[model samples]
Target: MTNAGAEGEPPLDAESLAFLNRPGLTRLWAAARTRLERGGLQPTGTIRLQNLDAQEREALSLLLARPVTGPTATIRLPDLDIRLRASAVGRGLAATLAELGPPLTDRRAARNAAQAERIRLWSAAETTLAATPLAGQPWARPWLEEIRRGGTLTRQPSGTALTTVTQAIDTLATLFPGTTPGPAPATWGRGELATRTTGSAHGLDDGTLLARLVLRGIAAARGADVPTDAPGRRALWRRASVIPDEVSSTVLTYGLRPRGGTWGEKTLRERADRALETHLTLRELRTLRLNMPPGTRVHVCENPRVVEAAADAGCTAPLVCTSGSATTVVLTLLDALATAGCAFAYHGDFDWTGIALANRIMERYRAEPWRMTAADYEYLATRAELHGTPSLPLAGPQVAAVWDAELAPIMEAFGVALHEECALEPLLGDLE
Candidate 1:
């Protein structure tokens, strides 16, 4: 035979054999090889392998029958020493491909079961509560807020719960006299108690209790002989007939009264209470000047003493005093004025807190910030001797975006707090 080779002999060229046997090329190819057997076919533009050597390329060619069109491809090696193709080779890949596993199915089933249970519980609770008397009452607002804030009537100390429940029972008894006292548990769960209490106390289902309370309130208002126990429905109806449409009309008229009148002294007080109750409008002074017939000039003060001092000085301007934290009266008055299309010019302390309060009043009632600008602060800075040292750097959560941005900065710069009453002389002069 020629020197070509013996039977079944391997390739004998040293360089060629060494090149074919190069570990770097094999290692690189092995590392770069993305085993996408468990994954879907790669998208068209994805890079499949990086840093290919000549031998690796030849090996890949011999293995692959067709050109690789994507990041991953299947290959069949018939003649090479190695046989490799994209196949589910291990438990991991097989598990993924078959899409079956007890753990996964169990987890999903558990989650679904939990959701179903929650829905069942919520529905049951809602159904039970819907039949009660307290349904759709305003008491739910604060109760809901308390619940959101992690309050529980049950968790309340026995003394407190007893007190509250006693009051509720007394109120209910007054409304539903001769009605059997329902099972009142000492410590019911929050949702359970809310549902039960609302239904029983508010008379939402029968409304006999509600009718009784209404009659009692009306009788009490009119100085009539009222029953201590639940008043008869017919008696309530008779009393209700006096006002005819009292429920809707009374609330609507009460709400509208503040915004309707000529900001008179008595009317101002009524509106002040309403605004305070509704809007929480607080101010130091409220001044009303009488310039024209039925004239309405009202000034609000942050300090009661300022109003008192103004009055002492024989200042005829009608005033309302906020006292602090704008009581219900102050807000009601403000709302009344606002409803009547009366424009308000507000002044407050020059400190950060005052700025915040002034901005709040302005925002809530659409009142104008009178002399609450940086310019105003700057002018006031010249008049008042800074005292009490700048308060611990204010925790400024929100600032009026519309007013001068410089206002906050100037307060920070001046490092002083000035109350509205301190600058009252100037503000009062402006009214003139």
Candidate 2:
């Protein structure tokens, strides 16, 4: 930099080469550069040179034209600037540092620019969601916070984060459309909802960035944790009225007939007559008729084996099996059955997941907990071989038992999972 142009400083002359290239002066110049750069290239404050060697002191004395002797010395930028301009350097400090290798950067300015860009990104995002139902909801803040914390929004190119936010808000807004306190939106296929809101059929598909973001909002709004598995994800979407295809989303049933002559009712009557099981889809249930009289107790279970057991035992109380996690079709069937004046006796496994399913059924449908209580868990847990099966260890996160408050804590204490199959004999007796 002695002979070449300084970094953001005026070009240096041959006469200043000795001073710019002088030994022991590197530390002073580096400190000055750092100070000025840190101050955003605007301040001319003092820079301290600590533990000065003989060369540094001599260089400083020569540069400042003072008898410098101390181990530390504070050099003022204004003095250096004046000296640099008048001396053979022929320019101020900025240009001089530029002539030196590695150009100076205004770190403060860089930070400010980045911050402004972030503000602009989110402000535009707010404008993007201004018209949606999500704009001012309580869950919106947490969603935005999670997005911010995850760093997904800021890790990409400009405008991309906003695009992501817009997609999530648009998809969510569509999934739960209409004013607050209104009826639930009609269920739609996952792809169809994604296409309508985000212009991509797979916009909200599982494992997609948009899917994760959207699920976070759904969980936050519902005060639930973000779903992690395929079944869990589908369940969350189903709760939001987004469903799989009618064919893919079906509920298993066995026994007892509705009085109506519609396809579902006739199918139920025929299935019950033969003691066979039938799986009903939303499409079929939508058009098929049913006429369950008031107080008609339809049994609901979380596993298909229960329905199988009921069928095998010739138990004809009309069982609906969730087959694991209850799908949208299962929920719709339950709602329809409830509308038709059918009471429900819901049973599930005795593990944490089963308890969760029971909570949802009990909370949503007011169904009675069938063989799903603290007493039932304790009785089943005590016998290693209940219903000819060994008791399994409870796995997964604990869920609150809304139907019976003591059920969750009891299960936690026992650390045993009494599956519905283990209670099959008694359940079969009840069914008969």
Candidate 3:
């Protein structure tokens, strides 16, 4: 009987032992051995080894001391010839049989399956949140459902009060045990906490988010981790000023004014000129108003060129150009005009872009839409021989909930764009 070595005994030729010393060679032999054990080769009992180089065959022969047969030749090893033949034959048979079976999955199918699973998870979460009863404030149920569905809520709830972060965490945990809530504000800083609270507010304006991000960026620039709800952050922004006056002047100028301050005719005229020359926004408008003259008439124009032309024409009425959205300066000037009781008439291009901008100004500052009606658009469409390049597509996502719903459809129908210059004469007529 051949004695196998004791379990703990070291081999006499430790360096040459394939399984113990050379992991790579041992792995190859084990894989071949497994195929032999599994009956994966061609014949039920015989192994037909192929794809082996002469060196690998010699190694196998030395390791097993077996007789191995391949497609080209049969090499006999004294002790293991039968085993090697069986392993190879089994591997070859399995490969041949697999080729005759059903097809394997392709890449597209795997991707689609993964996407379908993600949708299923998202849908399940939506359904679960919708059904769950929100305690205390019944109206919170819909808002919570919206959040679960990944929709942002900007308006404050008029019905039921909204849930707190702690309550939200609990409710979410019940629905999605796999998810963990993020760290509380105290972990990072007070400023971060304030920002998170403002974001989660059911009644916060959409602009609040933009303001928060801007403030946080400023805090980061100052090497501070700003809290989400930091009063300090707000105060810092209030104190900070933007140069050249155009950017910061508007919000600051209009924003700083007392609600009912009288802006007389003289005040409006002085303020409008100061705003144009200095590019002051609503905020800066407040500072300039202290010593402004009375009973000034402000002329509002859509194009900066109109403002320039008015100035060049020596028109004395205080003039302003929207330049696009009512910048802080524009809003400030409008607000000052309103306070001073100065009548304002606005005019812009008769195209869709003009209509949209007019709508935004009307909504944001309660400014009357200056000659931006459907009639105005139709009249301009017929009169202008050389219209500006067809109104370009809108820059960002359209918020139809607040905007003129007919504007997009009108632009699509016209298939052409008109600029402020096309309607310049009629607008100037209104000014005269």
Candidate 4:
């Protein structure tokens, strides 16, 4: 039997070896080549060949030194290996197949190498993320999982996309306070921040990998929903006090006095005896150092009309108006004041969005809810409805006044809206 060949047995004649390399053995060689490419071609395997011509059957019959019993038959790998060796072919069947068939690329090994590369890339990114301050934050785990599942760094893949994302994460980590001594407070434009951190001015532009990564981190840190559009993204950056753009953003103020010799101070110093309306552009805000004396109070209002009324009534109290839903400009001014040890008392309209804005402003600046309580809403709302004070219906879904938990239910129950102007006499009365 072909399998009975002893170890180190002399191989068959040279003519037999020459015949094995001929095209006659092509069909069997193709089968062996298929298995080798899939993985290592093992001994003692069977390959089923179909629709074999007379020549091919005769070739197999000769190679195995057995009768070719059927047009299609199972080829045991071990039988083929032993026969090839005993026939004085190259060392074994696999070696002969390589010579007779197209070169094998070892697809299984290629796949394994690709998988290993992917694991290595992810491990590197995770290691960097773990070492950063954002690692343990509320947003880290889900963000990391997204990276893993997507198989590419960030939402889109570019040549440096992974590196860009990692840099953004590291940069965002700098935004939080650390165990060590902290850096002095500083604010920057998005381009300036990108240039300083990643050495590219536009590295954190909208739709960029760095922007996407940092946005996710900020959303997690601030407990804000992830933003999708340009306006939403700009608003998020503004929340972080990172200006999206300078010229377009402005905050309104009156009765502000900072201890400095700048436009903000100069303007206020000139109008020392009376309140002066000032529109502080973001560009101007960046240059001014707000260092109000401790215990100073800065009243924040949701509407410009409140500031106007305060000014009109000769109210000397420092007032800031958000103008609408507080923009980044408003938050920036408020944050600076808050940092300078200025106490804030925030008042807004008695509506759903109004309560929400108050909650955000209060939470961010630690502002006292000025007349923003359930009792306040009930009093103002009841008075408005009774006095025939024409007002918009309390529109939008109800929002909880987290500062005063009882406020939301009272407002929802009243179903009538009241604005700060509605309580103008009382609000101005307190301002003086």
Using lDDT as the measure, the top candidate is 2
lDDT of 2 by residue, 1-432 (tens): 435574455456565766676887999888988998888885488999899999999998988888889999998898888987787767778777777657889989988988888888777767766777776576776677668777787777767777888888887777656544132557788888888878888787678888888888777767777877665776777777777555766888887688886666777898899999988877787676677767889989888888888888888787889887866778878888888889899889888888877888888899998888789888888775545655578888889888888988988998888778888888899998
Higher TM-score: candidate 1 or 2? Answer: 2
Local distance difference test, each candidate: 0.43, 0.80, 0.43, 0.75
lDDT of 3 by residue, 1-432 (tens): 112232343222323332222332343434434443354232333234456666555555555555334423232222243443354222232232222232223335555665565455445444544554323323334444444354222132311112322233233333222212222222322233333544433222223433443343334334455555423443434332211112333321211112235553344445444433324543345455533345444456677777655544544455567876665456656765677665555666555566666766666555555656556665666565354435443343332313345654655555555677766666666554
Q: What value of lDDT does candidate 3 attain over all alpha carbons? A: 0.43
Residue pairs clashing in model 4 are: 44-78, 45-77
Query: What's the best-to-worst order under lDDT?
Result: 2, 4, 3, 1
Candidate 1 residue-pair clash tally:
38
Q: Give per-model CA RMSD.
A: 17.7, 11.7, 18.3, 17.2
- Pick by TM-score: 2 or 4, better one: 2
What's the lDDT of the predicted structure labeled candidate 1? 0.43
lDDT of 1 at 301: 53
Give one digit per residue, the lDDT tens place, for model 1 in 338-407.
Answer: 6555566666666666666666777776666667778887777756545533343335543542567888
Best by TM-score: 2
Backbone clashes in each candidate structure, one number apiece? Answer: 38, 9, 63, 2
